[model samples]
Target chain A: MSAQPTVTHKKRVACVLAQFDTAADVIHAAEKVRDAGYQSWDTHTPFPIHGMDKAMGLSDSRVGWIVLGGALTGLSVAFVMMWWMNGVDYPTVVGGKPPFTTPSMVPVLFELTVLFSSFAAVFGMLGLNKLPRHHHPVFESERFRKASDDKFFISVEAEDPKFNADKVRALFEGVHATFVEVLEVLEEEVEA
Target chain B: MAYYAPLAALDEAHLVAPGSTLAEVTEDIASVTERTAPRGWWIVFLGALSLLGIFGGTVGYLFYRGIGVWGNASPTYWAWDITNFVWWVGIGHAGTLISAVLFLFRQKWRTAINRFAEAMTIFAVICALIFPGLHVGRPWVLHWMFPLPNQMAIWPNFKSPLLWDLFAVGTYFTVSTMFWFVGLIPDLATLRDRSTNKWRQRIYGFLALGWRGSNRHWQNYERAYMILAALSTPLVLSVHSVVSFDFATSVIPGWHTTIFPPYFVAGAVFSGFAMVMTLLLITRTVFKLHRVVLMRHLELMNKIMLLTGTLVGYAYAMEFFIAWYSGNEYERYVFVNRAFGPYAWAYWTMVSCNVLSPQVFWFKKLRRNIPLMFVVSILINIGMWFERFVIIVTSLHRDFLPSAWGMFSPTVMDVTTYLGTMGVFFTLFLLFIRWLPAVAISEVKGTMPQADPHFHGHSERSHSEHDAHESAVGGDLVPEGAE
Candidate 1:
């Protein structure tokens, strides 16, 4: 907390970016970045590079727990909704069965459980990833488009206390970065 | 023809074409969307559009003339509409089976086929829902299917299997659509990046939601995908089971059997694969995607069809055994009526197509035969439809009292509306492949050998630098000299 930088509305530095040619290169570069102790950085690739998670020193994802919570919520909602509708609210009998047939309610219960879990899975993933945040300073780099095509990249944010532009460039160069550059935060978009 | 090699034969089989690169995968799939519509695409589009028009016209007229236009009369109340509903819903299962089930099973081959099959599932489900909507006669009051508080104040029966089906199919549709869209996000970003024009960039970019392929995102994305797959596996199985319950819960001898759940599921898998193979074969050729959609993938799907088809055959035989062994006269009568009664022709067609036709896959050569498999695939679809017809119509038409027994003959409207759904299916499917990457591009790339950071192809020893990195990085990756 003590390392928090002073606010400067006119600050121009967005991030330092590095590009690599292969999955292996990206993985090795990610490992170097991890060893260098840059907290705010990510490796980008056309597809998930298999070993990059370990290389980047990431912990297990929290998505499973979020999904579990979602499933439980769904199960609860289904139970209450069915119980109130069938037993408490509008009671009726059909096919020689009593109202609030627990056995028959199983399908809807399972459906809602899965439904809410899936919602949690998708939106939980997006929220965790801070996605649907369409405006990001990283997109300003022309070379970054290749991150979704045939190339791999690493971007260390300027917000990181360890992120000195020249030092980041030197560290990337020490590894096998094919390219390295700094991106500036445009003035009007800083509020976002 | 070179016989399709099993994946165990390391010399021949590869996940993709032998030497395809990452650039090539992106280029191959993305170009399909970017390229101008081919002549064959236009032909199919026009044909499917006309079919869609027929669907629209028929539904409009049906809404005007009411449900009396169809052949739903006394005794045989549920006919082609219900039969098509089950058939189309059955066809929808292969998508989830491929995408969610195979994914959980770690079947790498599903990558090339899952997206294509999943789109098929959505379109098929839409087609299936049309039957029930129109079958109610009065379409305007369809909201009564839900438990809504209105003037009548009658809540839908929670115990009814019909209501259970609404929840099942509805959840199945919503979850799978979300699953499909979630999967599409990364691929959409690729299209956005590759776009040559403003509109393509804007649309694809908006859909992509600014996916930058950050490793932080992929970790969660992968976990979320896994959870969805886990959820969908049971959801897929339960969907067909609940659908079977629509009949299984009934006392209509043939429909009342305990085996209906597993039977319908097996039949769904069988018919769904047939539909997938039918569509995939055309898509593969038209799009020139033989490299990714390999003969090996087709052979694997054939093997699934063989297994499920055998299961369906067993269920058919077991139905008669149960009927006779129970010593219930009505059960025996229904079985006898199915095989030797007036609708015996349909019963035999079901047997020949659903049971006997798939047995040809016992031979490796037949399993790998493209033209033969295509024909069998179409036959199996027809057979599965007849299987539904046999269960619904035969069981209902012949009652305990001979006075109530009446035959079911589909009216022209029934026939046209049934075929019209096909038009709706293909029109949606064609537009899907045209606008979107029909293959899961990123997933395919992930499965390739080179996607692994540690994979150095056959020349692992040549990367001596990797030896140092391995020591430095604590060897958390795959072991040295991995294939």
Candidate 2:
């Protein structure tokens, strides 16, 4: 039988950038986005945009799990090291204490666990989030520099399948988003 | 548009007398400009300097004459060296806890005390380095702890807790120093800006690393700070735990207990907090930071002291009970002798200072009262030092068989080393206060109720939806680079 071609389209999240004078504009836009049933939408501001997490329907991150996993890995290594040292490498009976008792192993084990977990938490967070090698595409916009001072902006990704620039600009207009414009992703940049 | 004018009532144009400039209203701040020191301050500084001089001389003498010159001998090999080591290391803990742990917990009040605490960490660690440096017979071969290819071609025993101490202390000092200085950058910039003349400006400006408070600069600074805090929290806890391993992993009857790690950490926090209170009580009075620092911070720290003190007491009881229950005569004897031996007075003082004195803090009135807490903190410090003494000396004095047991006492040199360390600690602390902004101004400003627009009853004022470029991650969403 002839194979049927599967229909799949790339997803895009159209972001309407805004320079709101007051935080209330940001909140109102967030509410409007939520009402429009945009599940993959988010709001951006200079400082923390209060109540925006609820507006966007986002959940807590799994960064804690990454830390916990790293910590456990560290603890296991510590246990193995202790067991090899006291019980195997140079076993010397002192103060009539057992060579391989768990109580004596507790301190080193606990320390290694914390050491590894915290290390993992930090590096893992940075790695998973893909940070520190600092170049970003958003720097292309000249007006974007004003985002630091008095300006507030909202960016919707063009990669979302539903993110039609025209549709988003229209949506932004409906919500009274002044200066709504397309954030073009060049074909070469997209391909790269 | 007057958008840049501060909204605070005190920041208004006419908030002061109509004719008075903003400069004149804050003239009290300006008056400290003269380069003359108060005689009292000079006396204290000179006294600290002289003690520091003696410390240098004592260390030099010990190096030339050997560790045998100190009081460490049979039955008390660790006496003052180990005791002071533990005490100094314990004193270093509060700064990290105040800066990192409190920051993570979102306690904004830590800003007032964090800088001094951090400087305390660095100096206390420097003081701590002296003991172990002199503990081993050949102080010249101290670099043997580092994994270097030397004439003897020997590597340090990683299994040995002493080597672990080398690693732990070195790691701790490096990380803590980095954390402290990274936090000081913005504050250093503030100091640079405030400096009137060329010399101070040049010095502070160089130290400030060209920080300009740009949003991009603050973004990067915060990222680095968050990373450091995350790194240091575990490093601080682990370093002390590893330090406890110097004893816990040993076979010295009383010292060979599993409870030592948590016990040591709790004791470290207890002593560290006490030192903070001591410094803050004096500094707040001297520097007129009373209104800024406030009573809430002191009360919070006292509550912490009470909590840790209780934990320390519980650990002590558990150790005794475990000793008796283990059916080991040597272990049982070690605990019994600590309470009734020749140094029973020291032991009881430890109990009363660490256990009983902190009990007063259970009352909110006592905790909030500065003078009372200051006294309690000093007693707690005395008690904590004695605790380390009891741990190191009593356990070593009567270990294993009776024939090897002997009493030990600190010589005059031993006392001088400790006195010298106090000098070093205070001198560093004074310099830190004079040079750096003692508070994290940006973090503090961020926490002000005014920073939250919602607090000003203008939640609806933010609704001016003007389209602008933004990302979900907020203002500066630096996109991921290609692999």
Candidate 3:
């Protein structure tokens, strides 16, 4: 599919993967990998493993703060929109009520706040994950597909300063990983 | 062992059947989509499609004949259509309750049913929206329901409860759908991984967002899911309260009341759980998903129905008490008329179905009895529809002036239109079953005893400490469904 051959014809290694049969093994393996000092690495599994974050020495997500920001935006926007439309522009009169009233405005305020918070929650999570990242080298390994099924995996990317194919293999073997493999992909495929 | 249940009871409780592996959970759920369509699915789908056809035809005729074909007349202007709107909206609440409320409460068993309920929520909201959209009298001007710029620069009255209904229902549907889709992403990725061919891979892959299940992704995904759940908890309660506000804000004798919000909220949850129970009983049986959807889950759901149904019964009695206690002749008359006057049959039917039928659930054996629960579930829904009918029509049809008093009855068009919404609901539900994982497979896997990394290491006795630690994390940990 490539129209032009790159300067180097060799496929590039993306990451080194270690597979485990269960969540416990993968989590303990992650702790060992974390202690060994790898930066660009992650555990892959069908579902989130409890305590895995502490095991891997990762921090809490910023999605909460983003959600709070969204909530404030929704709150202010709802108030301003309602105030501008009913209070200032039209001066609408219904059932002898005032054109603008806080009590009357509370329902819309609540709804919009929730609506915006949800938007921020979904999108913030997606953005932080850098998702829709349709191509990655780890997917090239056939055994990696089980990451979403019965298996657990930890991958240390080529970008990690400590990354070494043989060293990663030795580390994974030390942790009793059931399988270990290196992923390689065409250079141009992941260029984007 | 990772669960909080008493160790004595743990021996008997298996959330996902014993010995089922993670792969099997995925296989069990995804197989419903991958396998050939069952004969029952075909029959139900065709029936639903025909109802949709009726819905389209009746709606067309309504447009051509201009809503007059229905038996909506002077005093009963809000009959049938409005009742259908409220009933469908109420049916959707069970989905949010199961997905969001149950999630926040750490109800691990919800994993078996949350996805199914969430899909129903989205579709029920759609069915509910159909009424307001068409009944706006001029569908083209429906944009006026929102704050938008136009040549005639008027805005929807912010003071009106109807406008709030617009906002509340709109926000409810959007958030609920977002919540459902977020939960689906990981499961969709599983389907993507399991795809045997290019088409399935492409379609499921697109929906899956190319999820690789990286821990970095899960950290934020879990947080987002939690936030959505928290946000939805209040939003679900508020949506129905605002729906009740439509009646409560009015000066009409039966409509004006202070107790409407909580009363309506309880009733919404009540009817919603009944709908979920009704549909779930059928879905599990048809799809052979008894392994994931255990009898214990059904019993738990029945218990919820019993709770909410009794709450609704309390609200009904409170309404009568308040009417008599208020010393307001009009209010007292409305209550008496509802019970002993022209629409007494409808009122009594509602009481019998909603209040009496669910009383059977108080018995443990009856609660778990498949046939009996099924019958009760269907009865609760029928009663809920009557509840709205009584509230809206009965209140309107017999207002203060006996001179203006008249009866409201459903014409064929009204019946057909309401039936068509059922078509819309079932058709969407059938398609959802045919394609999506009806169970939240990833969430269910999280609930499995094996999903907890600490499960195998700690003896059963020490697991309670881990369970406490899980709650102490502010429920950030996807709970090991060790219960």
* Residue clash pairs of candidate 1: none
Evaluate residue A103 in candidate 2 and report its C-alpha lDDT on the 0 to 100 scale: 67
lDDT of 3 by residue, B1-483 (tens): 023333233454668987787778888999999999889889989999999999999998988878788889988999999999999999999999999998898888898999999999999999999998878767767787788888888887889899999999999999999999999999898988999999999999999998998998998999999999999999999999999999999999999999999989899899998999889988988899988999999999999988988989999999999999999999999999999988999999999999999999889989889999999999999999999999999899988899999998789998999999999999999999999999988888887777866454232322354446544543223433322
Residues B1-483 of candidate 2 have per-residue lDDT tens digits of 001123343243221122322122122222233245455556778888998898888888887887778889997878998899999999899889988888776566676578778888888998899788778778767777675567764443345677667767876787678777767665555555566688976786677665443332333345546655776787788878888988988789999999998899999999999999998887767655554466877888899999999999999899999999999999999999999888899999999999999999889888888889999999999999999999999999999978998989888889888898888887877766654555454444334332332332132233322323222223322211100
Task: Assess the local accuracy of residue B365 in candidate 1 as a C-alpha lDDT between 0 and 100.
Answer: 97
Model 1 ranges with Cα > 4 A deviation:
A1-11, A189-192, B1-12, B457-483
Runs of candidate 3 exceeding 4 Å displacement: A1-8, A189-192, B1-12, B457-483
Better of 2 and 3 by DockQ: 3
**C-alpha DockQ of every model:** 0.48, 0.05, 0.57
Error of 3 at B205 (Å): 0.3
- Alpha-carbon DockQ of candidate 2: 0.05
DockQ of 3: 0.57
**In terms of DockQ, which candidate is strongest?**
3
**Which of 2 and 3 is ahead in TM-score?**
3
